[model samples]
Target: MNWLNYSEACARNQAVILAELQPLLATTTRVLEIGSGSGQHAVHFAAALPHLRWQPTDLAAHLPDLGANLLRFGSDNIDPPLALDVTQEPWPAGPVDAIYTANTLHIMGWPQAVALLQGAGRLLEPGGLLCIYGPFRYAGRYTSASNAEFDRWLQQRDPCSAIRDVEAIRDQAHACGFALERDISMPANNQLLVWRKAV
Candidate 1:
């Protein structure tokens, strides 16, 4: 039997994410995708953005499924999956053109999330783009009732996991020498935040 991890939400969101990624990634040659869950986006984006070499990374446990997905649908542009834990140092030694992470922060503890941002800062070259996609609270308030409920659910499931505020995220990103360049409102109350590494 063929085995590959699947995520309905990933399938649903990949297109919108790709639309946002295209222009942001147009000038990029190397991209590192953090938390490549299910590898759905890796396959889809690699097929669409053939010019970039997409490096997918995640915790070791997910490597098999991620690798399987890559073997199944990945093209030449998609590199083999790499083991990455944000809290651990030396993020694959990248001076990449772009860094992309989707639906990851809210699921991790805040400290790890901050570490991820810091690592992104170190990974990107000057003027590189950092794209983060997920629901975010604005001005300390949830954007929608559904997002509020989702935050509650996330906290209930894992105390460390909850929606992050745009303000807090900005502060963290700013500390890493990144500046918010674009904030695209995406479907399902999520936001695609683009931060540019200072040149």
Candidate 2:
């Protein structure tokens, strides 16, 4: 499973993300992780936080690698991966305590990102958390030179793929009844945006 290799960025950033997430997740019983690529982060977080159950989901094509990574880590708190594509008509299951997605938004087109937020709004319980982790543009400007290069690389691979604007994302989230709580700066020019569904 070459695709299952751990990212150096994931290694450097997971602990920081966990620190921010630990408080919000303390009361959460279950979390639905969107785009659980490689599954390294899933297993690591699940093992670290035994109280919160982690449900990993990704495209069907990535499931085998995800499953293998989960098994190799051997954590009971992590559930078997589910096939999930946010742009699809219906989500697999719903009403989770929290939803998390890392480094996925910019990889997908704007329509898919909007659909993902809309789906989260539909699936989250009242006041549930929606945490998105990755680098993003702000007010039509790139945050860093690295992100600019990354954006170029993404667009080169798929013209529809490019770094998103944080303000625009917050606007969409607000429209979906999700209130932005925090925008924590992370390593490697990334950020962790935390939102809560308004009651």
Give me the candidate number with maximum lDDT: 1
What's the residue-level lDDT of 86 in candidate 2? 93
Compose the digit string of candidate 2's lDDT tens values, residues 1-199: 3436667777788888898888889999999999988887787788888998899999899898888888877498888899999988679966698999999999889999999999999999998999999999889899899889999999999998989999889999999999999989987899999999998
TM for every model, in the order presented, reads 0.97, 0.95
lDDT for 50 in candidate 1 is 88
Best-performing candidate as measured by TM-score: 1
> What's the CA error at residue 154 for candidate 1, in Å?
0.6
lDDT of 1 by residue, 107-126 (tens): 99999999999999888899
- Model 1: colliding residue pairs: none
Assess candidate 1 and give its TM-score to the true structure.
0.97
Candidate 1: C-alpha RMSD to true structure equals 1.1
